[model samples]
Target: MDPRLFLADLEAKPAALRNLASILTVGDAWAGLPAPVDRVLLLGMGSSRYAAEMAALRLRAAGLDAVAEYASTDASWPPGPRTLVVAISASGTSQETLDAASGYAGSAPLVALTNVPDSPLARVADLVVPMHGGTEEGGVACRTFQHTLVLLLDLAARLSGEPRDVASLARRAADATEDLLARRDEWLPTVADLLDGRHGVYTLAPAERLSSALQSALMVREGPRRPAAGCETGDWSHVDVYLTRTLDYRALLLPGSRYDRPALDWLRSRAATVVAVGADVAEAAAVVRYPGDDDPYVRLLTETLVAELVAARWWAAAF
Candidate 1:
């Protein structure tokens, strides 16, 4: 993957998001999905799975029986007429997803969510929904990842019969992303230094928006080849708290979790360096803020730009 191209891919996020919003305003890409789905099964891997899991959580909260499973799994929910299987892959060629989707070919209603309309996965589905994130010359899933989350939010709204203006949310997220890109000169260097510890980068986010943490950590690892890990804010106390005691733990905290206070408490006691993104946290060594951050959906869609940009910077430096 070319680091320069990755940076350019990131630079184009605002415009990409705006285009998606405009497209969403005109029509529903999910029109072909069968109605009265009794169970929703989302199948994907890596970034696709991350977004799918979050979408499934929202669906469950809305009282729909939904689950997101790793496409590599050997067994999953049995295919049935009332089941809707959404197989997501930005390139529409993820082998594992294609294999998993194949099992439900005739037994269940299948939908393919992909950027490439003519890809193999699209050929396998009864209906194909385009990602519309355009191309990522960077050879990474930056904009596609963002678009997937936004589209999944729309999917959740439709399935749950929840009235949400997702197009408006996409526009807001675009504004927030633009704000961050324009102001990067002011905050990027500080965040880069704070998180440039030797051990690795740790990302934490609320369970509601855990994909932010997962995608952020993935960016650091995928782009810069750095070691990074993501953890849920509340689960940090049990899982990642020990690292702070021995290592020079440096972390990115995507605030908003009610459980944040306890995790921050441990970070403070251990003198761990923390960079708070989207919201201000007094314990953090630095805070990165952008427009429309007050909206949780905006944060969910936009906060990862911080880690992505940092990964881009480090990746570029290496080359």
Candidate 2:
């Protein structure tokens, strides 16, 4: 694999998001909801599912009752006609998402968000929001995932009556990523060396940064053809910590909350190879530095861009 194709795809996200802002405007996309919506259900698969989860959190924080569910989960069906159902699919060809959309035919007006405007999901949607991430032939949804998160954030901001200038944020994201790519010599060598000898990877983050961890894990799995795990910090401690005792795992931490410390400490004690992003940890094998700004939303794009590089590094070493 020519790694340039993948990195180029990742590098295009800023422009992709800028294009997305010019193309999509929230219409009466939420018309099906009552004057005061009590709940919303978002459905998607894979990276799209991670976007849904992030959007759901933003919506909930904006005072709406929202939850994200996997498109393939039978339990994700709307509770009633009152709850708005949002089906998100990057490819628009995900069978599970299509099936969910079909199941909710007339339950309520369905909103579809996707990269391919003409995908089957868009064809049936009451409102179609395009990702505008451009064509991706790298076989991974790099720009598409970032654009999906932007669209969902834009939608949530509109719903909350506090719309933002997404284009401006996108420009900043582009600048941040371009800076990192330009200075790859500083951090890439250390991060890549720690990952090179690992059997596989497991990424953990507080719920606050789980989306980045998920995207990172996705990149590692897809780009390097290696097994990757994404887990909530606290929960992984209770149930899956036993796996750490059994295996010498390479773990990546997307740190945001102090609550992540205990899990990081436990992983370190077990001889796990730990890499921390966004913060330096003395216990970690390496720390991939990210911006220290308090705004995690802006940090998301930059940090995930780092994940893309991590995957690309693994690709270079493996092939």
Candidate 3:
């Protein structure tokens, strides 16, 4: 069971995402509640949690009142009636998310975005947003995660009363995926060569790319057959930098504002084999660069495709 096959499978299912637009169109009625929502509480864990983080950022940027918290946090301190809880889980059966949904005290509506529509998360949600990607065999997320985030963003845009051209966005995102898949042969071999026999891997990024770091770690672990970890740029320097000398690890840095550039440079100087995504790679071990759109939502979609390409290469070589 070569995991790289999963990437190929994902590429074949590019229309899986376009199908989500229809799902959202049918589910759009949920966006038109009698009263506008006062706040949104997004809950999930691991990659699902990261998806919520990305969605929360988009919602905030659209001036939609929203916040993302771990399902455990939500379970401990639930929100009130004015809140809408959007629970995201690829496997729909994540215990923490289910438990949080069950335990939420508020009269607020519950929305679930999941690949497994029959699972418990969907059963509990007032409205279910089904992701088109099928089951993900490996523990890491690939197409499932990508579709989940995009669908959530689509829903957020519709609900926030923002002018989101879903058809245009979906088409562009699909095109980006196609572009990366086309170039897989060129970059895969290089990534595989660089990551061959590597023991530890670390991904660093700021803000939006922070979710990319988390997704990268999962892809390497589940797809590339490696033990991996991820962190924010400043946090990595303060906490994980010391471990570089003791443990053999590869670091991939995503460039952010000027604040992240200095830290990224320092990490590179420390002899960490850094790979840059969505930015220029200078003396880095490998670079998976993509043309990103100015829209944060679009940039996130592009970054995800780059990560998938890198993960597929590593998986082909290592697994």
Candidate 4:
């Protein structure tokens, strides 16, 4: 596997975040822009879909009615003047996103949130908000994901009618992520040793925050050529519990979810291993922690650094 390109994309995140911060500052006033519509539809696919999910959360928290839909399918909503569709794509070339953006252009104004401003999706969008993660040739979205989260926060600031220091928050996100990256040697090997030769790994997160679990599974599968599954906190009981037979599966648990510890206990008896990141859940067989502040939104960005480290380690070992 050619892992250098993937590693380059992952490593570029800190600078990408800093660049986003500089551009999203209070003075820039992008966040100060009035809400074009009270309802929002965010569209993407793969990890870009995950970015849309996070952006929907931020937008909803700021009191907007927002939903994220897979751009691969045709989506519909009640016709209203205060409705907008935002297409998010890292490459800005996804056929699904382009089609969705085009479909929505004549109805509600289409906004393009993408890394490549000149790409096809961008061309169809009535408004363009550059993702500014730079070019990612890794075939996976890494830094672009981070950039999207920061932009979502900037959007939240704008929609809330109370602009925040988005740049400062981005700096904090960069710092927190940097601290985790600094300890790659320590955390990566530990996770690798536990996961080495495992049949597959399961990733768990709250149902409300499925992006964490989805991205975790994506990293392992894309980086290590490993079979991986992502699950919601409650759904794993009915669906994923069947993996308990051989105890060959490991789990990367994103703690702070609703049913984590109880699920962790159940998984410990069944799961080969469970590693907790950010939250210190004692039930986990191993714990890799990062410094996170009070903002749960920032945790969304920083805590993901642990999964990135694990994926990178697996690449090094396999290659």
Candidate 5:
């Protein structure tokens, strides 16, 4: 299937997010825990793990005590009561996630967010949040990752007793996704042109956009068949910046909360080609602006959609 068509199919994300929210809310009701659960544990790997991190932040903002652990790491440790384990896997069959779920002998309830309800993770979960990305090709997760992030944001809101607000925010995110998809033909070609001959790429972002950067790097690797790495903006400023100058690398900056204007200017001064993907572009070599509220979660979803479409365009042009 063509990559554009595959990306267009991501429009089902809103409904998918709503369905997952309903399931989680109903499960919370049915679980009938003496009180709202206080502690939460999230587990996954790769982009799935990145989604867990974003979910942890949203959960924390919503007043729930949440933490994320890579599935491999979580599998090595046992969970305890009063903890809710949320497992995320785009394919629902991630080996590490499945192993973690099976190894978790603790009494805490398990919730799964996945595209396949019948897959291993779902089978072991006490509650399953089904993703709307029906099927994927080329082994790269574009739509699935975006949808999972949206669902997790909604899940966090639901758990925080703000279901209505979460739904509203999701709708806006879905709208932003649609807008980017509509204009993909124009922006993606530019992205493809920018990344044309680069043998390697690096994605930079703050903690909030860390997942976006990771997903962007994965898209470049899987879709464009390029070597890509992602690093936090703050950390990269200290260590990776010198390496980037040494390598004369092209950087894709998914500016997060920690984005320092002076640092970005300095990188530009070093002649690094920095492409900014987000609402406002500052001193970027190229910019792919996504329309949406400034909420990191919402912007992250929009940015991922735009970046994936651009990567898909590159993939199509290459192959």
Candidate 6:
């Protein structure tokens, strides 16, 4: 992907989000589903799957039976009239998702969330909910990824019986994205330096917002071809903590998890560098804050911009 085009794609995030907000205001995107939705099965790959996983977790917390599966999986829930299968692919041409979704085409209601409404995936869907993320031109999934999360959050609200003003949340997310973009000169340099360790970048977030961590790391690797990884904050101590002692560990911390303290203790003890986003932490070498960060929804929707910008910066430099 072209780095300059990627930066341009990121620059358009606020406007794209505002457009999505307006779309949500007009009508419910999922209104076309069949009568009963007893179970939810979300299928996707890459960023689509990342957003779906977070949405599935929220749905389960709301006491609904929901699961996000890799579209490549050989087996999944059986097709049924009461099942709602959401096939998400920004391009609407992910082969695995198309294959998995085809299984439920007639028996279960298939909903396609895609940027290209007329794509092959939409052809099989009973309902086509456009992402409205606009064209990336950059050949990257930045805008589509954010739009996916926002739309999936809306879906979670609908199924959970929770009346969330998703449009308002999208508006706030736009503001936050604009704030970050406007102030990039203030924090990008410091964050880039802090996270530019020899080993690579590590991203950590709470279970609820783990998608942020995963997507952030993916941006670094996808754009810059860098070595990067993501981990859940609580699970860090058990799985990733050992690397800090032997490597020059640098991390982007999305601070919301209650278990953050334990991971911070290890990082501090090992003298690892950290750049906190959306929330201040004691051990962070730098902290990036913006408007609407206090709201968890806003943080979830906006925090990944830090890594994305950093990725863009590094990628541009290399070329």
The sequence of per-residue lDDT tens digits that candidate 2 reaches over residues 132-240 is 7888867788888888777777778777777676656666666666667777889888887786544677877767667877898889888987888788788778866
TM-score of each: 0.99, 0.88, 0.85, 0.91, 0.85, 0.99
lDDT of each: 0.96, 0.76, 0.70, 0.76, 0.71, 0.95
> Measured by C-alpha RMSD in angstroms, how accurate is candidate 3?
3.0
Which of the two, 3 or 4, has more lDDT?
A: 4
RMSD of each: 0.6, 2.9, 3.0, 2.3, 3.3, 0.7
Better candidate by TM-score, 1 or 2? 1
Prediction 5 TM-score vs. true: 0.85
lDDT of 4 by residue, 1-319 (tens): 3577777777777888888888776345243233467787788888888867877877787777888889887556754556777788878899888887788776676778888889898888777888888877666677887788777667666666665777888888888888777777777788767756557778888765678788888888888778888888777777887786665878888766777766776787764577877777777777877666346666777766677667777777678
> Which digits, one per residue and each the tens of the lDDT, describe model 6 over residues 1-319?
7999999999999999999999999988778777668999999999899999999999999999999999999999999889999999999999999999888898898999999999999999999999999999888899999999999999999989898999999999999999999999999999998999888999999999999999999999999999999999999999999999899999899999999999999999999999999987978999999999999999999999999999999999998
The parts of candidate 3 lying over 4 Å away from their true place are 1-5, 21-34, 61-64, 74-79, 137-140, 244-249, 291-296, 316-319
Best by lDDT: 1
CA deviation > 4 Å runs, candidate 6: none
> By summed lDDT, which 10 consecutive residues of candidate 6 come out lowest?
28-37
Considering TM-score, which of the candidate structures 1 and 3 is the better prediction for this target? 1
> At residue 187, what lDDT does model 1 achieve?
97
In lDDT terms, how accurate is model 4? 0.76
Q: What is the lDDT for 66 in model 4?
A: 88
Give the C-alpha lDDT of model 5.
Answer: 0.71
